[model samples]
Each structure stands twice: as C-alpha cells, then as structure tokens.
Target: MNKASTARVTLDPENWDEFRSLAHQMIDDTVDYLQNVSSRPAWRPMPAEVRNSFSEPVPHSGVGAAAAYADFRERILPYPNGSIHPRFWGWVQGTGTPLAMMAEMLASAMNPHMAGFNQAPALVEKQVVRWVAELMGYPADASGLLVSGGTMANILGLAVARHARCGFDIRQDGLQGAGKRPKLLVYGSSETHTWVFKGLEFMGLGRAAFRSVPVNVDYTINLALLGEMLQRDKEAGHLPICIIGTAGTVNTGATDDLESLAAIAREHNTWFHVDGAFGAWLRISEKLKSLVAGMEQADSIGLDLHKWVYLPFECACVLVRDAELHRAAFASTVSYLAMADRGVMAGGIPFANLGIDLTRNFKALKVWMQFKAHGIGHIARVIEQNVDDVQYLVDYIRKSKEMELLAPAPLNIACFRYIRSGMPDDALDRLNNEILLRIQEQGIATPSGTTVDGKFAIRVANTNHRSRREDFDALLEAVIRFGREVEMK
Candidate 1:
C-alpha cells in the first residue's frame, strides 16, 4: 500500500474536527495565494541547499497530516512551476479554477471508479461525454471519454482510427501479423505538438511515418503544401491513412487551415483528426470560431478541458463520429461489467467503453461543475481578453528596437526575440540566450525560447485568464530592459 493509504488507515478519516479544520486551512491558504498571486515572484531562485533539503531520507516514524500540511504550505506551493502567475508566459499550461477545486474535493470524497455501467462513477463519465459531444455540435450518437490530457487522447483517437479501418479482428491478432501495416500517413504542421510523435510511436507508426507540412506567413498550416504532400504521397503508391490538423499549435498558437485540411482529407478518403487540446474552446466564442473552422468535419477530435476550460490537473476529451468503432477498439468481455446495448442509455450516451482506460477517475465532475458554475460566455470572454493581452504585447514588441517578431500574433501566442544591434547572427543568438537566462534569474517573469525559421526567439503565450493589459506591459518592459542589460555586458 502507498504511504498515504497506510497512514490514512492508521489515522482514519473519522477524526472529523481535526481533518475538517485542516481542510479549511488549506482551502483558505490556496484562496489567499490566488488572490495575492500578482505580488509574488513569477518564479523562485531556489538555492542548492534548499533544493537538497527535499532529497532528505524518509523518517521511520511518520509525520502527522498537520505537519505534512505545514510543510506543503512552506515548501511546495511557493516553488510550483509558476504556471499560475500572471507574468508566466512560457509554455501552454493552464491555470486552475477555484470552482474546479471544489469539484475536485467532492470527487475525492466520492472516489468514483469510472470503468463500467454498474457504478455511479460510470454515470459521471457518461455525462461528461454527453457534455463534450453537445459542446462540439456532434450528434447525440457520438462516443467519447476523459483521459490524462491531449497526448493520451491523441493516442486513443489514432487507436480508434486504426481499428475502424482495420476491423476488430486486428485487435485479437496484431497489426503486422494480421496483415500488411496499413500504408498509414499522418499530416500536421511542423509546429504540431511533439505528443503526436509520441502517439505515433505508441501505435507502432515510427516517427518517420508522418509528413510535416509547411506554414504560411501567419504561422497557420500551409494548406497548399499539405495538398501537394498528400497528392505526391498518393502518386508514389503510399497509402494515405489520416490527417492530423492542429486546432491551436503549441508554439505561436498557429491553427492549421482546418477547412482546407478537412477538404483535402475528404478528397483522399482519409480519417480527419483535429488536435484541439487547448484551442477548441474558441468554438464557444462566435468571434473566434472561425479559427477552428472545419473542426466539425473531423472523424475524431482531442480537447483538453484542463487548458481552456480551466479544470485542475489533466483532463482530456477524445470524441469520435462513430460510436461503434469506439467500442470495437477498446471493449472487452468482462463478466463483472454491465453489458448494455450501445444506444440504450436513458438521458444520454454512456461513455464507459469509449477508450482504453478502464479504472478511470471521476475527473469529469470538476469540468462539469466549472462549466455550470461559470457560463460559457464568461470563459469565452476570458479567452478573448487573453488574446487581446497578447496583441498588446505584440504591439509593444513591434515598437521596441531590440525586439523583432518571429511570427505574427495568432490567437494568444506571440513569438519574438531580442536582437542585438550590429551584432553578428551567431552573436545575436548568444545575446538572446543571455537575456533569457538573466530574466529568469530575476524571477519577475518566466518566458521561454523556441526556434522560429532557424532563429532563437522568445515565446509569449497568454493562457492565464488573470493576465491583463498591465501584465503584458510589465513583461514587455522587462524584456526590453533585459535586452539592454545583456547588450551592455
């Protein structure tokens, strides 16, 4: 048994007053942290001694929950990867919502196992699927499931596509042993998440199996290049298998030309999959829905509620057009599980047999609660504000002599870099790296770097809802100041 479980068994949850008091203190502390987040440093400069303290050996005598709680408050919360801070314009991680935290507490209390229909947890999973399908404008007949986030969802979606094309017997036998490896081809922009490569590897499709397409000036996928690649692949006797389009890219927030990509996939009679891990929320905003145009045409779509919907930890949704293929890919005959007809659920679809995960957690409760507590319009406005904030940064970066745009603002991500005046190309690269390292050491902001067209650039992704015009202003000022300091040195 795990240490927490063994400790819990000995202490038991029955010491009601103490545990309740502890929980209240923890909640209050978190609320305070969120309220005062703007004042805290975006990141910490942990000393080597402080870092080594965490590596201390475990004690034979157990510490009480109260002590552990105090340690968490003192040590852990302060040093979190700093995703919640407003000036943290690094990667695409999302901030957690307070309403979702309450849902997490409630879900933990119930501890639902969302594998089969006999359990209440299974019903929770079913409801989540219905919510996702309805949100995406899919028919009530769709099938879906919550996973550990976009990577798993992509993997699951590819598994479903493979099974649907190959049939259920392939699951009984193996992929190569059953027949020739279907001349599978997947397409996405060069900016697509690395998770797609991982998904391909897990599915027995080597990394080289994918065809990376080019991007246009706005950083969106170049549909012309994609069409050319597909046509060439077909002419070369290569089997075109699937098209993976990006709904929101991880780098500069570039969306693939989903409308054109879908049309191309349709012409080739290939499976269309949209990786909308963070960007699909645009569907809620009529103004931004055009960014993900043609997403509805996807045979399967992957979305991350944790990113856009502001749920805690990792919760991803994988939706498929055909419900039968979902069950055919992942279902097993377990005597302990209830066997119901595919479409026989009462209010909506039951999602138990939709994917590979069986003993899933009640992750949907937090997302459901957050959606109900905060209307879709409110969240859409938050996203719109983030986009505006990024645009503000874009304007500031354009005005700065030291900074130049690597890619234009698309959605909420802007890629730019600090350029040294009169410095050689290689020297400018070193200067930019030095500024980034200096800015990180200062701990006022946390921005990351990426290569754009073979040049090192800083990526400012405005995903946190708390980010405002002032936050962007501060970040721009910091970048300019750091660039000056690095150049002077």
Candidate 2:
C-alpha cells in the first residue's frame, strides 16, 4: 500500500505536550481575569481596529492553537458585555462563578449529545431538571428540560400549555382546525415579556391571541381586570387557553399575585403558566420567597439558572406539572431514532421527547456542578444580599432630592430616574438617556434603561452575586454626577 494512500487527517494536535502547555496558560489567564475582574471597568467599548479585525476572511487553514488563543485573549476576552463585573447590574444578567466556568470547560471537552439514550449526561440533565423543579417548589414528579435561555424555556412552557388546554388536537389539526370556532386566547398583563407574543407568533397563533390585561399601580397584573377580560372574551366567543403570571416582571421586578392568578386559572379552567426567569430563585430566599408565593401552583414554569443561579449563559428550564402532558406536546417517533431496552440506546431519559431540538449540548453539567459546589443555601444568601443591596439603592434614591423612584423595588430590581425639579418629562427623558450613555461610556457602572409608567427609568436589576452595597452606592453617585453633567451640556 502507498504511504500517501494510508495517510489520515486529524484535527488533534501533533504535539500533546505543547497543547497541554497552551491549555494551562489559557486556564491561568481565565482565572486571572475572573480574580481581578473588579479592577477593570464594568464595560469598555471595543476600539475600531479591534472590531474591524473580526471582518477578516475565514481561514481555510487553521491558525495554530496557541496563536488562536492569543487572538482570543487580546481581542475577545478583554471586551465582554460586562455582566460578570461586580458593578454591572444591567439587563438581569448573572455574574457567573469560576466553578461554573470550569464546569463549562469540562462539559465542552466531553461534548455529549444530550438528546438522550443510555448515558451519564442524560441522567445528569434529568437530575438537574428534578433539582430545579424541587427548588421552584414543584412536585417531585414534574417534568422539565433545560433550554438555551428564558425565551426558549418560556416558549416550551407555553407550547405545552397550548397543547394541553387548547381543547382541540393542536398536534394533528393544527391551529387552522379550530376554524370558525372560538379563537383561543392567552391572557397576561401588559408587563409580560415580549417573548410570549413571539412564542404565539412562532406557534402560528397571531399576536392577537395574546390578551393584554392592564397592570395595577404596583406593576402587577390587575386580577379584577384579568377576570373581566376572561369573562368578556368568553362571552364574545373567545376561548381562554392560558393565563401567564409573571413571577418577576423584567422592568421592575414586580411579581404578580401568582396565587391569585393560579386560582383564577383554576376557576377559568385554563392552563396557568409562570414566567419565573430570574425571579424563581426567590423561592430559595427565606426573606423574599413569599413574593413568588403562587409560583409553584403554575401548571408550567419557565426559569433561568443563568440569571439568578449564577451559571453561565444558555441555561434555563421549563417545568410542566403533568409529566405525560409535557412529553405529549413535543414527542416525535422516527424509525431512525427508535429507542432500545438495552446497550448504548436504552434506559436513559429521552430529552428529545420533552422539547424542541434534537441536538443539545451538556448544559446541565455546569448547573449541576454549580449547585453541588456552592450549595443552594449559599446561593440563596447571595440572592438575598442582592435584594438587600437593591433596597439600599432604593432608599438612597428616595433620599436624594435630585432622584425619583419611578417604580417600586419589590425584589432585586429598582427603576429610578435622575430628576431636576422642574424639568419637563421629555427633557428629563433626554437628559436621563444621556446620563445612561455617559455612565456606560465612562465605565462607571452599567444599569440598563427602561420606561416605567411613561417615564424613562435607569433600571438596576441586581442578579449579580458579586455586587455589594458599595457598588450600588457608586452607581448612584455616578448617576447623579452624569445627570448634572448632561443637563449642563
């Protein structure tokens, strides 16, 4: 046989020792980055040259591992979105733990295809799902699966709810089969995340399917109005299929009366779904758990471990109270993917039967490792501390004459605005917007902006376990300083 004919190509490095050395260096660099994250700015804009570097043509031949790692360290590592920073409170993002980072690396190295079959990864995912269900106070028999994030989790939950409660065979007849019958409707407050509407659209239910109930002064769904809408819609030949209760609204962290919503859902015989996202972790906190009182009563709950549980991105779970119904919504039978009673093809949970996506990564590893390492009690304390820090900021905002509280800080988020006593609403909006930009640009602290009750608000959503009262104090100081500076300019 010709030697040339026998040659094989492999992506593995020819020199394992050199590769190991590079890997060690990469790990050290990551540790250093996390260790000293507090010394760096919460966020920094990427320079034009660095941004332009990404536009380079894709390499047909690989840059050696060390060289590629150098590029990542120089260009990508330094310019994160700042969620990991101690002072970064923007957008309900979590500051991930170093342990989770290690778990991520381990998971990637194994690269398990988590769609199911007899495998330890499959069992790990099942255990993680069980833990999440227990954490959220759901039944031990609840069925769930981890997804990319809150959006996918929520979509899955709603998908199950729609299938189980739509009063027709959604799987077989599709939405069109409802033809000329009462239009199915999902009820939620105006404060519900835009993802719900997107989910409806994706499910072939138009945006009209979502009935937006008005929010009360506290930014929660008004129960009376919700009931009225349900009755009115019913009388008008509309079928209410689901009632979405927000465990925590994105803007203000306002929790709807979930128990009441559950009761209402029961009374109406509609599926009750809760978008817990970051707020479901509040169940772990003794001091704040009461805020999410009725959350467990939800027929389905969508939540994120990445947000409050401090895992890395792309980790969220959707739990359905009825295990069979959950599987029935998404299960598919294919000859090529048939299960077996033994060997590599059998006995483990088939995650593919629970939700969309056949090709899934080992997202459960990081979650399992994080929970095992830190313990839920420790995580709960961190969550409580975050809420306490936000309350401290709220108190500071209340005391400051130049600042106005735009919304109630019920859990871990506070929405407030910098105010000049007589400044018009429009002008104040512009000024606060400028202030927000300046704060981000100046690398002070990153608090996102949102509108509350028609007023622009600097929204501080504290999911960061790294944040402290001092960080929030610093944030307020920068806000006032920028507010005055912007007004003058």
Candidate 3:
C-alpha cells in the first residue's frame, strides 16, 4: 500500500502529531505573511531558475513536509500576483479583510461539506442564501448556492436558465438527444467579461451563439441598441433565450442600464441574468444602487463575495428569482442517495439542487462573519470611498500633461495611459504595455492594461478598501516618473 493509504488505513490518523504541528506552523507562517505583506514588495521579478523549479516532478517519498514548507517560505510565498498589497491595483480582485481571514480559519476548522441537506453545511449555506437575497432586496425565500468564483456562478446561472427554457427533463435524459439547437441565445455588452464567453463554452454553446450588444462611451451596454437587436432577432424567428446585464464590468467598471435592460427582457419574456460579480455590492449603498436599478428584476444574479465584501478566496453566490427553476435545472434522484420530496425536513430547498456542485465547501461562514462584524453601512461607506478615490485619480490624470484619461472614470476603475506625442498607434500601445511590465518588475505596484477603442491604456482598478488618497498620489507620481523615463529612452 502507498504511504498515505497505509497511514490512513487505521481508524486514527497515524501521523496526526506531525500533521498537526505542520498545520500550526502553516497557520503561523500565513498570519505572519498576511501581516507583513503590506511592507513587502508588491511584486517580485521571478528569475528563470525559480520558474523552472515549479516544473520539477513531485517527490514521492522521504522528503519531509517541513522541507516542503521551507521551499514555500523561500520561493512560492514571496511570488504572487500581489493581490494582498495595497498598491496592487492590477485587477478587480480585492484584498481580504482581517475579519474574513479569521472567519476563513474557522471555516477550515469546521470544514463543512455543503453538498446536500443531510449535512450541517446545508444550513450554513442556507444562511448565505438568505443573506445574499436580502442584500439584493429580494425575498428571503430566494435560493442560491456558493460557488468558486464568478465563472462558476455564471455557468451555474446559465445552466439554470437553459433548464428553465428547455424544461427539466434535460437533467435526467441529458442533452445528447435534446431536440433542435433550442435556439439558445445569450446577450451581453461588448465590454462584458470574457467569462461570459467562457460560460457559453461550458454550456455547450459556441461563442458564435452569443450576440454582443454595442456599448456607450462609459462601456455600458447601449439599451437602445439592445432593444433594436432584440426586435430584429425576434423578427428573424431566433430564440431570445437570455439577457445578461453587467453591474460593474471588469474593464471600466461601467454598469449597464439594468432597469432598461430588465424592462426589455420583461417585454420579450426573456430570461434576465445579471453578472454582478464585483458591483453587486452597490445594493448596499443607496447612493450607488441607482447604477444597478432593477437588479431584482433579474431571474438569476451572480455575485462574488470575495470582492467588495472582502471575503477570503473563492466564494460567489448564484441567486435565482424562482428557486424551483434552479432546482429543475440541477435536481436529480438516486435510489441509494437520500431522496425526499420537495419541502421536507431533509428535502426541499436543498442547495445541491440549485447548482452543479454537490460536495461544496462552507464558503458562507466567512461572508456571514464579515457581515456580522462589519455592518452593511460600513461596507457601503468603504465602497463609496473607493469610488471617490478613483474619481480623484481621474482628476489627477486629467490635470497631467503627460498622462490622459482614455475614458471617463466611472465607478472605481479608470483606463488611461501615458501620452506619446508623436508615436504611431501600434508603437504607443507597445510603450503603454511596456510601462505595465516595468511597473511589475519594480515590485512597487502592478497596474493592468486594456484597449479602449483600439488604443492601449493603463487600467487602474480601485477595488481594495485599503487604498488611501496617499496611495493614489504615489501611483500618479510613479506614472509620471515612469512615463518620462520611457519616453526619453
């Protein structure tokens, strides 16, 4: 037998002492890492040797976990995408809050498997479902399940939408012989996250099946264009299966006109799906809620708890307006498994029936703890502050002669770049991307890049609550210094 099997063959854990000690060390090391990360480099230029280390084969025997831990301390831990660093504005990812971190520890300790109603995890996830529903101003009866991230949430939501449109029997009989193409059509803004395409691919619909609606200057879907397209599609006898509205697109943080999109969906009887990955928290702020007006009109909504909520990694919720439709998409019965009718003690409203996952993690506890510790108002204020900071940076960019705003800073993400007076379009794009690379190599900050109307621009996303006005000022200084140096050379 293998060492792992041999160790676990007995009822008790054979190396429990060693394992427990290593776990304690891991926790201590992780705590130290998180605490000191603010002072550490925002990123590190990984040498070729270290990159090659990751390619080596696994050591099967004798190499102690302590040795493995040493390697981690020396290498892997130091080199991340710098998500935890306050200066790392590269992506929409958020640095988890301390409260959420502690809650994460507790969650790991409990290790609830939220697959079904028979487990304690079910109750915990149920609490999350209720909380997410309430946040969106929906009824507490709304059903949902926690998934890894926005990608999984979108996949699950699309699956439910498909089932609702095609009927429930698809789950049992499979799509193998399912009649026709079902004319499955999905709608999203041109600026929608690539995950929209990823979800379509996962759902067995090719990228060609989706219709990308035009976006306005702010990068939000133009509702008029969407309406015209919908009318045209209906006239062509095409199925208008689903309409997806973004509450904060990844690129520019522009929210589609949700109320208008919802109205259009209702008029045509199309399933409305909202991918509110980072921006759904706008529901918490009455001031920002107008941006996502009519989000509740969505038949299904996807929200990432990790972002904005500052929860630990991999927690997203897929909420459906009709719980039964969610069930119809994912419900199955096996003779050996605990099967009960809908609404019984161990039966109805089971989260497992709402999504693809069966052996799910207890991602709810951390989010729950965060909300309890920091009230909704505190989060709203933080989000508002982030918005203000982004606006401040936008103003700063506008004032600078060397830098220019590529687009109006909307929400908390601004896309801009260093202006090159005489460079061609292709050359300017390369220089801006080079600046992004150089910034990462310097290990002070890691800003991203995106294209706006065929022009490459620096993408700064203010999703971290830790960012202050000083941080924004420093970023501006860095941009100016870097831009001068790059242009001179």
Candidate 4:
C-alpha cells in the first residue's frame, strides 16, 4: 500500500491550547468594544497607510490563525462603517446584542446548511417563520422564509407576484416568452425605498415597468391618485401586476394608508405587496401597531429582522399568503435533491422551494435567540425609545432659529436643515451638504442625506437601541457648529 504514506495533513490548528487562548482573547476584545462603543467616535476615516495595507496581493500560504486574528483586530474591525456605534445613525441600521453574538458563535461551529430537509436548524427556521407571522398578525399557516436582507425579500415577493398575477407559468415560459402578454407593471410611491425598483430589475422587468405614484407632504402615497392610476392603467390595456405600499418610507418614515391600498388592490384584482423592511416590526408594538394597520392583508411582505429586530446584518423575511405560488416560483427538481418519504429528507417544506439560494446559513438562530433573550415587549420599548430620540431632535430643531423641519416625523426619522437669513436656496443646499460631510468627517455623528420637498435635508434615523436622548443633543449641536463654520468660510 505504498507504505501507507508517511505524511499527514489536516486544517486544524497545530496547538489547540494556543488557538483556544487566542479565541478567548478575541472574544474578550469584541465584548469590550461593544461595552464601551458609545464612548468612541461615531466614525473615523481610514488613514492612507492603513488603506494601502489592504492593496497587497493575496498570500500563497495561509497565515497562522494568530496572525490573521491580529490583522483583523488591528485593521478591519476598527474601520467598519460604524453602524454598530450608538450615534452612527446612517441608513436605518441595527446594533447587535451580545446574546446574539454568542448564538452566532454556536451557529458557526455547527455550520449547518439551513436550506431545508429535516434538521434541527431547519426546524428552528420554520418555527421562527411562524413566530414572525404571529407577531405580525398574519395567518398561522402563512408561508415564508428568511432571506439575505430587504432586497432579496423584495425580489422574492415580486417573483411570486409575477408567477401569481402574470396568468402563466413564469418559471418555464419566462416573461419574454409569454407572447402578447400584458406588459407587467408594478406601482409604488415616489418615497418608497429604491430596493423596490431594484427588485423590478432583478425580475427581468425593466425600470420602465414600474410607475412611481406621487406622495403627500408626509411622504405617504396619495390614495386618491393611486386609485386613479390603477383605473387608468387598466383602461390603457396595461396589466397592473402589483401595488407596493411602504409601511415606513425611507425619507421621512411615513406610513402609507395600508388599508386603503389593500382595498384598491382587491377591487382591481392585483397583488398587494408591502415593503415593511424596518416598519414591519412596528406590529410588535401595541402603541404603534395602528401605524401598520393593513400590513397583514398584503399578499406578500418584505421585512428585515436585521433592522428594528436588532439582529446582526442581513436578515430579512418574505411572507406570502399563497404557499403554492411561493413554492412554484423558485422550486426546482434534481435527481439528487429528490424528496424522500422518511429519514433526514422527509420534512415537507423544502426551504429551497420557498425562495432563492440552495445553500443558506443558520440565520434563524440569531433571530430566535434574540427574541427569546429579549421579549417582544423589550424590543417594542426600544423602538419606542428610538422614536422618542428623533422627537427630541425635532423639538431641538424647532427651538433653534437657524434650523427647520423639512418633513414630519411619524416614526423614528427626522429630516431637517439649517438656514441663514437672506441665504439663497442654491447656497443653502451647498452649505447643508458641506455640513453633512463635515459631521461625518469630524466623527460627530453619521446621519445620512436626503431631499425633502426639493430641499436638501439632514436625515437622522435612530434605529439603534443604544442611542440616548443626549446623542440627539450632540448631533444638533454639531450641525449648528458646522453650519456656521462653513458659512464663515
């Protein structure tokens, strides 16, 4: 047998003791960072030298775990986009919890493919879906699956809409191959997040396939106009495949009249989808549940657990009313993946049939642990506090003679800008833009930008549970200081 070969190979560490020590140290470092993160700057730009360090070519030989860990600690971990920081208020980001972090470690160790078949992880995922449906006031048997994020969730919802509404088998015939078909159309408000548009493109429907209906000053879609548009589309021989309502718009966090939209959808025999990415969690809040009143009526909903649910990055769910349609859109058959009546392959719901991705990680663990570790009441209270934090900003802005609100704050977003007497609109826009950049560069706060009623406004979104009222005070003070300094220059 050729002497059975003298050499041996394995990817495990050479010294288990050393590896264990390093892992413990890294864990401690991460905990320390999370514990004291609020004391640090909201963000800091990477220095040129540190940035250049990443430009090096990949190494042919693997570095020891210790060295790789050191590189991550010294370089990558410190220079993230800063969403984990309490004052990092850019783009409705979530701040993770230590409990979720521990759950993540266990998941990584097991490393199971969660894309269905009978296993504990898959079972956990199915249970999580049911829990989410119940939390959101949907039917107990509502079919759903966890996805990467809001974007993929939206894509899944639209793909189902296409299969269910297009009046043909879209899986095999394809959109183009369906001859003389009604030109597939989607409708959403102008203030809806861009992910809806991206979803249309992903479904092989061009941007022209969607119609952007106008929204009122609060950024909610005008229902009267939406009804008119639906009627007009039908009269014009265009197929209105779906009407997407935003539970909380990106610019101002305004919720559309969901019940009215649902009524219109039924009247027109069209699919109604809700982009409730962050706002879907509002269903958990007894005080705020009315804000998303008609969300449960949606044929499909795209909601992100990574946002208001406070899970780590990238955890979204797509819930569909019609289980068969959801499965029909993405399910595939392969001899190797054929269903078995018993054993590990016997679970009825193959998650691979529910949505995209044949291989998925254990995402439901973090979500389930997060919910169990902190009850719904606790999460609702955190979301309520975030809304209060933004209300604090609104009061501060109103008190300041130089600042004004550009849009109403219905949820947790505040859109406002600084003003100076006799300043032209163009100059004011430039000044506010500069002030935003200065705030980010100075690491004071990380509120992003958006246009409100054609005016450039600072869009501060308080989605972090770690945020306090004092953080809003600091952000307002920094804005005034930067506005004046740039004006003087």
TM-score of each: 0.91, 0.97, 0.91, 0.97
Against the hidden true structure, what lDDT does model 3 obtain? 0.81
Q: Write down the RMSD of all candidates, one decimal each.
A: 4.1, 1.5, 3.6, 1.6
Tell me the lDDT of model 4 at 136.
81
Q: Enumerate residue pairs that collide in model 4.
A: none
Please give the TM-score that candidate 2 achieves against the real structure.
Answer: 0.97
**Stretches of candidate 2 above 4 Å error?**
1-6, 174-178
Candidate 1 lDDT over 131-158, as tens digits, reads 8888787889888889889888887888
Model 4: how far is 169 from its true place, Å?
2.7
Clashes of 1: 0
Q: Cα miss at 454, model 3 (Å)?
A: 0.7
- Model 3: per-residue Cα lDDT over 375-404, one tens digit each: 889989999998988899999888888888
Task: Write down the TM-score for model 4.
Answer: 0.97
lDDT of 1 at 356: 66
lDDT of 2 by residue, 50-164 (tens): 9988988879988899898988989999898899999898888888899999999999999988989788989999999999999889999999999999999999999998899
- Number of the top lDDT candidate: 2
**Candidate 2 colliding pairs, count:** 0
Cα error, candidate 4, residue 302 (Å): 0.5
TM-score of 1: 0.91
Alpha carbon lDDT of each predicted model: 0.79, 0.90, 0.81, 0.88
lDDT of 4 by residue, 1-489 (tens): 477566788988889999899999989998999999988888999998899998778788988898998899899887889888888888788888888988889999999887787789998999999999888878988899999998899889988998889876565776677676678889989887888778788888889988899988778999988888888888888899999999888778999999999999999999999999999889998888999999999999999988898888879999998888888888878888888889878874478888878888899999999998898899999998888888888888888899999899888999899999989877888899999999998888899998888889889987898887788888888888887888544
TM-score of 3: 0.91
